[model samples]
Target: MQRSIVRLAIGAAVFTLFALHSAGQLRWRLLDRIETFTYDARMRLPAQAQSQAPIVIVDLDEKSLAAEGQWPWPRDLLADLVDRLFDDYNIRVLGLDMTFPEPDGQSPSRLLSRLSDSAVGRLPGFAAASAAVSAQIDHDRRFAEALSDRAVVMGFVFKQSVKSDEAPEQGVLGPPLFAVEDAVDYVAPHGFTGNLQGLQAPSGLGGFFENPLVDDDGVYRRVPLVQAYQGRVYPSLALSVTRAALGGAPVSLLFDPPAKRRSLNLEAVELGPLEIPVDEQVAAWVPYRGGYRSFPYVSATDVLRRSVEPGVLRDAIVLLGTTAPGLLDLRVTPVARAFPGVEIHANLIAGMLEGQIRKKPSYYLGLEVVELALIALLIGLLFPRLSPLAGAGLAAGVALAVVGGALLAWQLGAILPMGVPVVFTLFLFLAQQLFGYFVESRGKREISRLFGQYVPPQLVEEMAARPQVVSMEGDIRDMTVLFSDVRDFTSISERLDARSLSDMMNQFLTPQTRCIQQYRGTIDKYMGDAIMAFWGAPLPDESHALNAVRAALDMVAAVQALNPQFEARGWPAIRIGIGIGSGDMRVGNMGSEFRVAYTVMGDPVNLASRLEGLTKVYGVPIIISEITREALPSDWAMRELDCVRVKGKERPVTIFEPLGPKEELSSSVRESLARHRGALQAYRGARWNQAEAAWLELARREPERRLYGLYLDRVRQLRVTPPPVDWDGVFVFKTK
Candidate 1:
């Protein structure tokens, strides 16, 4: 029973580390995305559009084209319309939805044989002297030139992986118009902007990714900010237009990684006056003024040819797009079933100028952390001590209070994280109850195994007031494992008497091993001076690898940082050897059924020990199996520590040594790392003296290291009593 309690105490200490580290990482990612998800389309589109004034649209209708005759209108006719807007009505910009990729069909063939062809009248390089452009071509072409000269935002696409049979001259309008919310590679995955029937040449373009946002009920939600395409991020059509209207400021999507809050960037810079609440991906619900065609749709022929009165264009930004049945630009919208696309632009402009923006802030992560702590603390403290009914009542009250708190925070301009507190609270609470049922004693042991490495002993005791989460019967789970051993302990043991060895072990190994348990690593067993542990078992730990790998590093750190103090007291300094690996492992009681001992058993466990043994051969402290290295977060740098098979293994396992926290390692340290690897490689190649020189240098920096001293003694002995002639520089261990 006493032995069980000791194990429990150790497990609890380690278990707490497992809880805190995983809690920190998860709270960062999940909560961050949750915060950004609040940004909506209804608000942003309006804020930007209204800010850009003097905009208008021209729509295609059956009546306008019928009266104007078959579709392909002549350049002279377009030129005439341009003259009217510029000369007759004094409108400043005349954007065209039409392209001049083809020659004006209605130009008078023989009229331009001499000097009559103007730049606007002919295609860029027509062989024949272009004839006088027809009324249609003359009107539209002239209008395009005038608009082009008025600082109008020109639109065109880079044609990413476009179709081979597509018209070479045909183009979509604009570049990726906005930044991604949490984008690392800058891919636009949520927009789609299609081309019109070559109408008013685009002033600016957006909406290429244009994916519809669907709510929980499978209904449409908000508009997305950008579209990720071909691994590149692009801007939405609304964003492009807003950028153009706002005098061509670069537009980017600002994403906060921790909070997942999203806002718009104008002029390729930080988000200005427009702060729209969006998801971490910047996809949001687009509340419409009503469905499609809610805006007043006028015939293009009416506006361009002066058929409509002057007052009708009064201070209104017009958008030109199609509504004719054959064209199919018509679609269902909030206001109407057959909305004109042009009016969508106008509405956005109106909304922007009116300052209709909604904001989602970056505090979302903190809220989740605080809430989770609250729930975990509450459930742990209350459930065990209170009556079942009372516990149930308290839980219900807490739920109501939490929901109310969210609403209250929202009202006060604070968007608190909503789901995490509830989730963590429920998980911790339920796990404890279930733990109590199966093996309360074992559960306590399990807890010590997890948090013992990362937190203080006192803090762990405070947390013990809550529920226990350990179980004697382990469940299947993915985990990160760490294994470590003292180099040459067998020889070192031969030299000391049993009592001296025991005292030395207590002096050195006790504190060193305690650090591992402090990091919430599950202590598997101790083989003399060796310690074996794993992370992310007995509970779900998404950051299992990160926790275990980092804990191994921390163990080395704790030992090194204290070694000098040990030297001053005439005690031998401690040096550790560690190996880390991550993967699925079976963990449970593994001894004889009569005397079962809880432990993890799998390839990962073996590999972890192997990795640790390799550290001595490679002259480094922290070695990780390849799988564990790959599973770690990308922030840490690990040096490859050569590939080798242990005595009983066939396949070679690639081993790596973690230096320290990546941020603190310097050039001098890196140089030492480089020299150390080179010397270790030489030692493996039977260059014993070269290996000896490397140790000498390392000792210059770190004198009296336990592992290094062991190696130096072995080398001296080998020089005098060498191995057989066939000896390759391989060291083999007889037991685990």
Candidate 2:
């Protein structure tokens, strides 16, 4: 009886842990990745319900390359292909999965323009002679005219800037049908590379060809229907082609009223007669038919040669794109590794047209959580009360139930995660069956196994080998603590659905954790989108501050690299503010009896959190307290920010920004730093005029830099309200 009670207790505890993690109270990235793999497996189930779709691809394949020469094929050839699709084949709609960012260089008009600019066209009869040839040989003008008043859709791409505040203007665009409320939360493209005006103007309908978003595994899954660029919304190539096919009907976005409180949640997009479901980001899953060549593909050369059969393409919507390996147009998709990118759009268009695309909405998460809890409860209660044989039968039954339920959902065209619940149920069943056998060895074994999940492999190994060194007792140590929080996270969260948001956060936080761990720092905990980490615990480092500073700088650079992926994913480009502080603090495994964590705590740790909050105020990405700056190497380039008392702290402390190694500083930056230092001195010495003049010059030189402008504002305000003669140069902050 006692053994049964103990076994039940352990099984329930285990089930609770796994069940909570499955419910998303605690995230397990490995399980999430596994869920994607499971989804990929289920998605491979052949979609046999629909007939051959009405979409055909005009592939610029290897055969076309061999017959028609290399890509950037003369605009005349493209113009010929376009005319053939609409005129000869009677295709319903023509979509170009390509862009023409510049005028065709091989055109006779360009040659004539060059000649007119030089001494050649200036000759007596040469000008008139070339003018006649130029008008006839202007291929772009010919292509533009061919597309005018036709069922044609052109493609363009959006390029996001690394510096979020500055965006370059390019290309003309048509506005989207719907306005996204709280537009800041939407994934917005800051800049774009678009088609030439001559070509774009005549197409009358076009959309961006770029994905700019992908799954966490870098596989093409969902494609966005619309993207916001500089407050204007534009559709994608797939959406545009569908719209054109539907007689140019404007798309209607259906939103969930409940989610509108956070930010608008796009439930579905309505075309003329078809309604397609999409996630909050306005993206839909590509309902792949099978592997590559799932749709009919006719070579562009065949279309141009007029060698294709009559009714094969008649009334079919044809998308023009390349499949040549050298063209680099192939992409990794859930269905195929080397699928032509064009087919992805075709699948989406066809799936939406047929209403076969599976949708996993936000409400599905609640359903999954409930299902997991019930299954976990059943396993926990039944397994403990049954004999070994009976328990085995019950466990198998539960496994079959979970898998059967998942398969039923799949057959009905919905994807719910089954890996976690199935794995959790089986684990508990086996653990209970083996509990009596491993009773003597379970104590140390379980501790080692559980600890291994949280700490680094090296630390776990040492703790297992020397158990005396591991304890829950507290100790004081001089350590460096770092705090990092995503800027505008609330808005970011509002842009994505639960699963997509989770995947995006995982994609972002994984690299950051690597940066800290790479610098030998231990992560204390994650507070939502913020990370709290420390160096010099369990193992002490004399240069913990220097290591923390290096990690901070690397994290900023890492985020810069991550922005492009984020931009591509239609998720918001993110920025992080980092704060680092080094001083004596408490370090140990601290928590209640139920759950303890290896972490650090002290005034210095609290101050690090406070400093991170100031990054937004300072308009900088990284900030550090004076103690951290003092511990750094002399070669480090540091700029004094301010001497202020934080809201919760009593004493005033100085803050600084580290600008990497001194040797790497540019000459212009070095000069600005010199001027900045002089300005700081003048401001502290009560020479308002000198301070104002210095800051004005710095602000003019770097107009985008807010620090210089901030100082200018301060100097101007102080001049109007001069400080008392005995006043110190300390600023007091009243909020954290």
Candidate 3:
């Protein structure tokens, strides 16, 4: 419970940190960058519907420059192009994306007037003839006449900074949209470059083409629709064009209630029937349709030659701008790098007219805080109770839901914060997972330290998985016990020095212990040169007897394999005898209070020890009691040794020697086993002559065979001193 509280506190702290950042109490640059990235990604997605607003770009491209000469084309040509757009094609409104800051220097009247003041003025007919030509070819006057009484919006630039000695203003600015006393915040410009006086005076419509709100990353994602200058508000070129296209509708600034206006809380820009959303800085989000060339482009040369499609420009709002490299009008936008600046204004004008400008309102910060809080509460309360896998799934689901919600809000013309909530969910999940890992690690370490020495490492690991099921108290369980001891270890230990003896013992016992553990048997303790172990303890195994038997066989092989190395080291070759038995036994931690050990004890354990002693008598490496044999699988190949009563045990228990798996027994071994069984049967039935003959034959076949010789001698004794008829065929050992 305390751990859960710590986990919750950690999660809450994380949420609080992010919430503070969202609520403007703190700043995180990473979150801002990620938010901008997500915004760009959304802008690049395929639009559901193409913008239906009829907007066209009159590109003064390289082709137009080739046909109509270089930039700064004479004002007479511009006048002709304007006439073509307004008269022939019947365009709705024309917005000049380029500014004319000075009068046309190539005007014929200015040139002729200058010439008239020169020595040519002294000629008789020079002044009269120059006057006639000047009246007919005055380019500036003709260009101004074309703009008169036409719905044309001229473009201008706003300077963000100006030097003390540099000029602060140029040309003539259009009428302001609002006074400086208006109750709204706006971007303020230091200076501006407006169109020429004669040009702007005739049209009486102009807008600033500069974007003061370009992001810090140098990407143009949003543009200020209106800026404050010289105590008056002015609209952007796109806003001016949109207003002119809508029959000169008046623009009004919308805002929240006066009480909610804490920090530049302007909401939208109201233009007649269209309500264009604007951020706090009075900037509108550019709803880019795609990359460059999203809108129709008509070359200036084509407009001049009247070679465009008949209906392409009819009633369309046209923007005259140059895409030539020398003109330098390219901008980096969210959808495309090096996008034509004219298309950016075109996209804005189209979006404003369609009422599709996305919004980032002042309440978005509050919404983000709420979203983060709700995500934190849901994850924090549920994560502690869930498993690791379930917790990961919950985190993923929450992240997906957050992103999906943000996308849905984007579709509805609202851009909620997308990166913070998703990142917050991920960080919170990691915190909880790390905390849970550390907490669980403590329990695992305790289990390992306590049981690591007694059981195999794998069994200790298994016990750690479900620690609730592990018990240390003594209890009775049906299990298998194994006892192994080196043959003649007392003599071998005396032959070596103490250090060498210890090394030999370590070398001999390490592999033997590993063999026992390899088959899932747990080592109870190492008794000098002997090892005592059991199976089905600490962790349960139904096949305990089979595992013990297999381990005994492997242990004998392990000793035999170590003999050659021992001989090379001038030590005696080693042999080990292992005995196994299976029955109900008291198993678990048992000892005095000062030194408790997890061990097992019962009659079956004693039986296994006694069997280990008997292996030297039978000259065999492994022996198993009858109960253990019965517990093993039927496919095991074992040879019956005897039914004997060791010292201190009244009832006789049958024992056998394990050969190998049934499928692995050689034919000769099978024949020897069959003959030995026949001999045992005959002897048990008291057929003295037949038993004697069979034992003699087995003894003669292998002179070094101790079991056959011992049986033969027993047959002879039984023949000489025959007991009562009720006597059972059980061998009784007086000494162990």
Candidate 4:
């Protein structure tokens, strides 16, 4: 038990370090899958991508709306359209994208409200107006009575991230037919499942936002067949449409996660249908229509208002929806932007009906695991026994094999999660190569005794796995650079003696440095009491700027707690200036020929120092350049500081002073900034009086600050003695 525990602990520690080191880059977040990621419809693609559906779309176009009596044209008009299709045309099935959620305006209040624009969002007012419509249902009873038993499917949508809090009327269809489901299938640490909103569809089929799962790039690709929603797994619109078109016979879906597959076991003896287009793990490929014109479209008002000339609706399946300006039911498909939502359903129904549904086999993970294990075993267990070049060849061969195999499988209708496995195998291969180097060097030279004792155990394990990483050698990669300096370090250094200064420096640097390390930032080197670090490489971080900003914020908090120690020691409290920037540069061992030292050297590093310089100039503690600002998510609010070029860089980079941890800059500060920037622009344009007036407004709002003060000094000079006529908004720099 002890041996097993120790081995497990060692392995865990090793994997943890591996993850941390590789985690140097931005980690793809799996949080809030529903909100963050929007899906594509790939589940319907396959053999039917080229198939055509004769279903015609009766669009309630803006032109039709303008021609017919505007939107919400009386139900009499809708009834007339339905009657034409049923009696005169005979479309196989009629789908209504518009709902009669409320009364047909038989009530005077509803009629008055409709003409008065007070019914802005009161569509499908069925919930509230059902009682009034009770009489109408009996009166107009003609259309309502016809729909009561008609093969007409109605359209509905959920409240998906509404932009406003305007409460919408609930659909009379009741709660979402879909229920929240348990994790009944494969587990890859990601993928979504919930009970379907409406499990029992009254229509032929129900569709979902099976938005194709295209990579970072948008493309119509793959989709899942059985999406576990609410509690029951609901088929995609295409699947449901296909099943519905096929007369929806009972069939069994068998999922074998261990085998990495799903199958549709058809038992429909009536249709003698054993057409299991869905394969292992109940996934399929979606085929797309040739284009938008592939499906015939007839405006809704045309179908309802009888504008369609005869022969258009004969033997056609009619799907109805709006193309009115107010109805923004448009999606980015290989089709038109004015594409109707019903057409998407039509495509799915057509695909299913034609049995052109392609399946996306789900054994991708299992195959990836086996391949990774094989490669790992081959490299870790056998490749090390070969020469270096042979090992290199083997590793390269492994990578090529993995990539080629995945691509081939993709071509053959399979999409495996090969990213992690391929990465893990490559990591393992490189690790073994590095391990060989470490062992070889150990054999050649006397091993250093117990270096792991001083450093953290985690760091020791990290250093062991790939000792070359620990070597002075470094690689150039884009990383976040952080530079923080004590505001009055010069005065503090002078106040204390050599011992006292060293003590204060150690006292201050220890915790501040630890904070950076805690957030996975590398400590490049410390200058007196200042700390500098980067987030990429040695231990990569995709969110280096974010991480660096977090460390800076945390460092401030850490020093806040340590202020008592400074107060007790009769030393001045430390105020810090932090500047964070993200860019590409060389970060590694750099020293004289006599001795090499580990550090970073680049223009971005220099820019980081300049940004720190701006903190004092701007009277803000933490300043970040626009590059850093761009790297962050939109939620983080920051004020723009200056549009000045740093000393070394040619182009002007915007600088932003990040207000300390939610303590946002006051409105006064913001207004002052607007006036400041305006005055600066004016002053540079040689408009002295205009600049003075703007500066006056800014100064009255906020006290004299360095930036405004600098501009004021320039304005004073211009008022007294104006100089160059060719002046623009360029500030001349004299010092680096």
Each model's lDDT:
0.56, 0.81, 0.88, 0.58
Instruction: Report model 1's TM-score to 2 decimal places.
Output: 0.37
Please write out the lDDT profile of model 3 over residues 1-736, one tens digit for every residue: 5545666788889998998888778889888888899899888888545779999999999999999999899999999999999999999999999899888988878888888889988799997888777867889889999999999999999999989988979888877887766656678889988888999999989898888888888999999999998889899999999999999898987767745543366788899988999887788999999888889999999999999996999999999997898899999998888999999999999999888899997888888889888888888778866778999999999999988988998899999888888889989998888876787668778888887877788787677656666788888999999999999999998899999999999998888888888888898999999899999987888999999998898888888899999999999998888889899999878888799899999999999999999999998899999999999888889989999999999999999998878899988778888889999999899998888888788777777868998888888888889967987889999997
lDDT score of residue 294 within candidate 1: 45
Total clashing residue pairs per candidate?
Answer: 139, 4, 0, 66
lDDT value for model 2: 0.81
Q: Which residue pairs of candidate 2 clash?
A: 212-568, 212-569, 213-568, 213-569
Q: Judged by lDDT relative to the true structure, which candidate is superior, 2 or 4?
A: 2
Compare the candidates by lDDT and give the number of the best one. Answer: 3
Local accuracy of candidate 2 as per-residue lDDT tens digits, 1-736 = 4444666576667766776675679888877777777777776777545436689998999999899988778898888988888899999998889888788987878878988899886899997898778878898998888888898888988775646564465666644656655432455887787788888888788888888778777898888888887566789999999888889986776666734633346567788888888776777888888888878889889999999996889999899998888999988987788889999999888888888777776676666667666765676566555656787899888888888888888777676667877777777777776773476235446545655544556655444434555565699989999999999999989988999999988888888988887787877888889999998866667889998999999999999999999899788899999998989999887888998887889999999999999999888999999999999999999888888899978889999999989999999989998998999999889898898899899889988878888888887888889888886888889888
For all predicted structures, in order, the TM-scores are 0.37, 0.57, 0.65, 0.40
Residue pairs of candidate 3 with colliding backbone atoms:
none
Estimate, for each residue in 86-204, the C-alpha lDDT of model 4 and write its tens digit: 77777666666554445555534455445445554355664466455544543234455455444555443333333454544343331222342333341111122221222113233
Candidate with maximal TM-score: 3
Ranking by lDDT: 3, 2, 4, 1
Write the residue-wise lDDT of candidate 1 on 267-344 in tens digits.
Answer: 112334555445545543343444454455567677666776665455444444566777665544444445555555
Give, for candidate 3, the lowest lDDT window spanning 10 residues: 256-265
Stretches > 4 Å off in candidate 1: 1-58, 61-143, 151-184, 188-237, 247-312, 323-326, 330-355, 359-736
Q: List ranges where model 4 is wrong by over 4 Å.
A: 1-48, 53-55, 69-73, 87-89, 106-142, 146-149, 157-244, 247-294, 301-314, 322-325, 331-343, 356-364, 381-400, 403-413, 425-736
